[model samples]
Target: MTDPLVSLPAFREAAAERLGAFAHTTVPDSPGSRRAGVVLCVVEHEGVPSVILIKRAYRGRNAGQWGLPGGRMDEGETPEEAALRELREELGLAVGPAEVLGRLDDFPAASGFSITPVVAAPSDPGPLRPSPDEVHSVHHVSLARLAADDTPRWVPQIDGGHLLQMRLRPDWVVHAPTGAMLWQFREVVLLGREARVADFLQPDWTRN
Candidate 1:
């Protein structure tokens, strides 16, 4: 039997009712600020509502760190298009615009991009064929795990601000802006609460 808590019907219903009604915040792009889009690709895995993540190959500045399936938007592409394209390029999930559920806030990342996290569910959510050139590994984080009360933690930063951290595992933790994004997704989408993460500090530590 499928767990209704994590079933596709519930997910779709929540997005339609909550996400469609939630007034998501967006950051205005400033000069010199780049734009990127990330897909919060949700799926039903093992009867749990799960989201996809990628451990990037040791290739970029933040290589080997965890991320969603996305990249910087192309000149003519919308955020939704960029997100879906990246999902295809990096994870082989060729979902179209119809799969996009809604969007969360625009996180102004310390890394210089104003990132829009697009919530989506592939029509054929499946065994992801992650690109070897991009992803070191793929992970499915269950909403049940995310909704746990003790999942998010605040760690002191060198700058007197606090950085948000959450354990995907004791060994593999994700931090803001990814951590912030996930936390908001949990609060707003999963649990259907009003929450924002603009004040969450970007991480000061390396994933490794």
Candidate 2:
């Protein structure tokens, strides 16, 4: 049997409902702990629900890394506010606070900042104008691709140990803490499952 078609409004409604029900965890701000907000922007592309990703312009440690469009929160700014501002700055998508579905746990990054993932949708997610100053490229990955098997994997790190990663088109490995944020969005927002992101060293899911 063929599955029924899901309209854009219906999809967004479902997402909002699921995300709102989840209790998001917060990481308290400590000395030397900065606050950064990364958006999990969802859109319907060719009838599929997709998420936006960005490749950082070659700039020190974050160069060439695929991540959500965002940056450090400005003084007195909320996480959702920062995420929406980033959507406009990075991708030219004028997303608003109303489109912000919900949020995930605060992820502690090796870079010494706590990242807050704000799940949202743009009013007009269209032809993106990426900022060369910050974005090297843009990708719209389908949510289905994220929830698929063999996507979130434990990859061998160069120095030692391993890090969690999410594989995209043609085997592009997005390493954590970006990978960790994506996984949380997939499980908590898309799949409507309980999830939490701690350190990037381990998967946050407890199902065995």
Candidate 3:
């Protein structure tokens, strides 16, 4: 039998329901550790479920890497607040609180930071303007693409957890905490599995 046709509103409502079933929490901030917030901006492009990502500017610690649009939250700002603000700051996309779908588990970064991933679905993302100082380029990645067979692999670590390698193309590899978060998003939001990727290790290149 063929699957039923689901409209975008129906998809968003169902996605919110699935995401809301879990209680999301933030990792305790370690004293003197950096705190950052990233967003998984889900948008429907040509009837395919997709998320927006940005290539980091080629100067910072994570230079030339693919990542979610976000930055360190201003003092006294919440993660959700930070995510939305960063979206505007980095991509010139204004999204309201009601556009947010849900939050994923908190991820502790090996780079001495605790990061939060906020999921949002905006009905229409107007023109995209990437900030030259923070983003090199912006990419719209579809769920169907991310779920492809050759996209992800598990490399065992010395510790017990596995390192998740998410490939955007043949030459590009996405490292945690971005990889871990995307893996979680794929597993939970896309596949509906109770998956967790908080303990995954970052690539050695991200340790600077």
How close is every model to the real structure, measured as TM-score?
Answer: 0.92, 0.87, 0.90
Give candidate 2 regions above 4 Å deviation.
1-7, 156-162, 202-208
State the lDDT at 65 in candidate 3.
Answer: 82
**Cα lDDT of model 1 by residue, 44-138, tens digit:** 78767788888889887578888888989999998989888988899888788887889999888888888899898665855578899999998
lDDT of 2 at 26: 88
The model with the greatest lDDT is 1
lDDT of 3: 0.81
Those runs of model 1 whose alpha carbons end farther than 4 Å from true positions after fitting are 1-4, 158-160, 205-208
lDDT of 2 by residue, 1-208 (tens): 2211134565577778887788888899888778989998888777877888888887744777778999889999998888788878988888878778888898888777788998887667667889888989888788778888778878786668677778876658876788888988878766778877685674332110
- Output the better candidate (1/2) by TM-score: 1
By TM-score, the best candidate is: 1
Ranking by TM-score: 1, 3, 2
Against the true structure, candidate 1 has what lDDT? Answer: 0.82
Residue 21's C-alpha lDDT in candidate 2? 89
Instruction: Give a tens-digit lDDT track for model 3, residues 94-117.
Output: 888999889899888887778899
The C-alpha lDDT values of all candidates are 0.82, 0.78, 0.81
